[model samples]
Every structure is written in C-alpha cells, then in structure tokens.
Target: MRQLIVTEFMSLDGVIDSPGGGDHPHAGWTFKDIEMDEAAYEIKGREQEEAGALLIGRVSYDEFAPVWPKMEEFAEYNAMPKYVVSTTLTDPQWHNTTVLRSLDEVAALKRGDGAPLLVHGSANLAQNLAAAGLVDRYHLLIFPILLGGGKRLFAPQDAEKQKLKLVEHATYGNGVQMAVYDVVR
Candidate 1:
C-alpha cells in the first residue's frame, strides 16, 4: 500500500498558515525570518525524493502552480505528478496535474503500490484526510516560535481522535525539529 504523508512547516503551537508574507496574518514566522543552514535544505531534499507524487489543497496549489514550476532548481518536482484537491477548479495549469473533487479519491490512489503520496501545506485537506482516516503518516517540520493565532492542522470538531506512533525524529542545525509518525488505527 502506498503511504500518504502529510508534511508541513508549522510553528511550535501548530500554526501552519501562510508563512510567506501578507497572505496570512500570522505570516513570515516559519523559516523566512531566520537563517537556515545547508543541512535543512539537504534534509528537505530527501523528503521530496521519498514521495512519488504531490497532493495539495486548492489554496496551496494556487500558491505553488505559478511559482515552483517556473523555478529551474525545482525541476524534479515540476516534472512530478501533482494532484490538487479542489471543488471548483476546472483546469489546472501545472504540467502533469489533476484535480480531485472529493476526499474518497485519495483513498483509491493510496491503494496502488507506489512511493508515498505527499501532501504539503494543506491544513484543511490534512484535517479532512485525518477525519476520514486516510493519512498513513505525518512528517512535520516544527519551527521554534508559536504564532499565537493562525490556521491549525487539526480542526475543532467535537473531539476527534487520532492514534499516532512516533517513527523518527531529528533536530536540524537551524533549531527546526522534524518529527515523523505513523497513524495507528
């Protein structure tokens, strides 16, 4: 079975909102504010290679479609398959991209034998996948600060529960903590 890994750059308090700038009120708190070393980049590169495909929420898709594809350095990701979960997007401009309207479609994709399908920067989609019990693993890169108020990975929905077992962890030179866990049922 193909694993579905939800990866995100979050704050200490679990805020995964827009970290770029202006797009989210709690923006610019992730890694942009500080300097990172070569180790973090190398680690991230490894994570990118472990996934066969990318799964992104509509918002993240929109944010990335115009940027990552144009960057020459991210050639591998630009060429890799991308699946965007969106309700209204009819046409996806990114090469090797497809739009999925429902969460059930993700389950079918995971049934195939392949490298893990990675979901990045999609808090809402991650929560839905969590609620549906579809996410197999979670790889979070948690930064040091807490953004008091911002988007959260887990939503407030009448006490939902998830059983997660820590599989691996590492601390980068930039004070970024990486945690990988498998979801247990």
Candidate 2:
C-alpha cells in the first residue's frame, strides 16, 4: 500500500498557518520568530528527496502551482506526479498534475502502487485526511514559539483517538525539532 505523509511547519502552540508569509498579521512568523539556520531545514531536503509524489488540497495547490514550478529548489516536486483533491478543479495547469474528486479517491490512491504521497501545508485537507484515518505518517518541524492564532495542524474536535509511534526525530539549530511519526494501526 502507498503511504500518505503529511508535512508541515508548526508553532509550539500548534499554529500552522501562513508560515511563509500571507495575509495573517503574524505572517512569516516561522523565520521572524526563529533564527534561520541551514541545519534546521536539512530534513526538508531529505524528505523531498525521498517523497514519491505530492498531494495537496485546492488552496495549497493554488498557492504552490505558480511558485513551485518556477523555483529550481522544487525541481523534484515539479517532475513528480501531483494530486489535488478538489470537486471543482477540472483542469490543472501544473505539469504532471491530476485532479482527484474526493477522499475516497485519495483512499484508492493509497491502495495503488507508488511511493509515499507527501502533503505540504494543506490544513483543511490534512485535517480531513486525519479525521478519515488516512494519513500514514507525519513530518513535522515544530518551532519553539506561541503564535496565539491561526489554523492548526491538529484541531480540537471529537474524534476517535489514533495512536502513533515516533519512528524518527531530530533537533536542529534555533530550537527547531523534526519528528516523523507513523500512525499506529
């Protein structure tokens, strides 16, 4: 079975929104709040090297399409297959992109042969995947700060508890931590 890995940059307070800069007042908090250190992002390079494909929601797809394809750093992702979960998206302009209609389709995708699907910064999509018990692993870079408000990687809601096993972890410069947890099934 193909694995689904959700990756994100989250605050100590669990805020995962606008980490790179956006409309949020605390936009770009990740860099502003923590000192930039190349060592802190080594996991990012490693994960991208290992990821087989990219999976994202409409909002993330929209936000990344124009930017990733243009950047040399994301060449691996640009070449790999990309899936976007959206009922409304008919045509995708990004190269090697496919539009999936629903979470059921996502589940089916997981059943098919492929490398792990790496999900990046899709808050709504990530939450839905978690609620559906579809995420297999998480690659998180938790920064040490409290961004009091914003969308979170995990939200407060009533749902069955899902067990996880910490399979890999590391701490980098500026007090950033990388934890890779696999969902215990």
Candidate 3:
C-alpha cells in the first residue's frame, strides 16, 4: 500500500499557518526573520527526491499552483503526479494534476500500488486525513519560533487517540528540527 505522508514547516508553538502566504497575520514567518540554512532543509531536498506523487488540498493547490510551477526549486514536484482534494475543483490547471473529490478516493489511492504520496502545507486536508485514520506518516520540520495563535497540525483535544512512532529525527545548528514519524496502527 502507498503511504500518505503529511509534511510541514511548523513553529515551536505548533503553528503551521502563514508560513509563506500573506493570508494570515504572521505570514512569511518561515523566511522573514529565520536565517536560511541550506543544511536545515536537507531533508526537504531528500524527500522531494524520494517522493512519487504529491497530494494537497484545494486551498494549497490554489496557493501553490502559480508559484511552484514557475519555481526551479520545485521542479521535482512540478514533474510528479499531483492530487488535489476538493469537491468544487472540477479542473486543475497545473501539469499532471488530478482532483479527488472525497476522502474515500484518498483512501483508495493509498491502497493502490505506488510510491509514497507526500503532502505539503495542506492543514485542513492533513487534519482530515488524520481524523479519518488515513495518514500513514508525517515529515515535520519544526522551527524554533513561536507565533502564539494559529492553525495547528493537531487539534487541542482529539477524541480518537492516534499513536505515532518516531522513526527518525534530527536537530540542526540553526535551531530547526526534522522529525519523521509513522502512525502506529
């Protein structure tokens, strides 16, 4: 079965919102004050190299479509098959993009034979996948900053207890940490 991996650059206070886009008050916090260290992002490069397909929600797809396709750094993702989950998104403009309307479709995709599906910056979709017990893995790059209040990866009180096993972790000199976890079934 193909694993569904949700990856994100999150703050220490568990804020994943406004990492780049200006939709949130603390937008662009990912790069604004944080020093750009090549070594800190090594895992991101490696994951992009290893990912088979990309999965994202409608909002993320809209936010990334124009920029990521034109950016050279995201060339690997540009070439890979991309899946966007949305009921209203009938047509996706990005190359190799497909729209999956329901969580059931996502589950089916996970069951199909393929390389692991890497999800990036899709907060709502990621939470939904976890709630549905469809998320297989997580690749978190936790920064050393706290933005106080924002959208977090997990809810404050989750009714369903989903256990996770830490399979890999690394703390960089730039105060950035990379953690890889597999959901314990």
TM-scores across all candidates?
A: 0.93, 0.96, 0.96
The window of 10 residues in a row where model 2 has the poorest summed lDDT is 153-162
Flag regions of model 2 displaced more than 4 Å.
Answer: none
RMSD of each: 1.5, 1.1, 1.1
Q: Model 1, range 1-185, lDDT digits (tens) per residue?
A: 88998988888888889876537765777657756766655656876777799999998988888889878877877888899999999999999999988988888888889998999888889988888888989888888887878788875676378889999898887788888889988
**Candidate 2: residue pairs that collide:** none
**Candidate 3, position 29, lDDT:** 89
The true-versus-predicted C-alpha distance at residue 52 of model 2, in Å, is 1.4
Clashes of each: 0, 0, 0
Question: In candidate 3, what are the lDDT values of residues 9-47, reduced to their tens digit?
Answer: 999988899798758788998898588888888888988
Error of 1 at 127 (Å): 0.5
Q: Which should have the higher TM-score, number 1 or number 2?
A: 2
Provide the global lDDT of candidate 2 against the true structure: 0.91
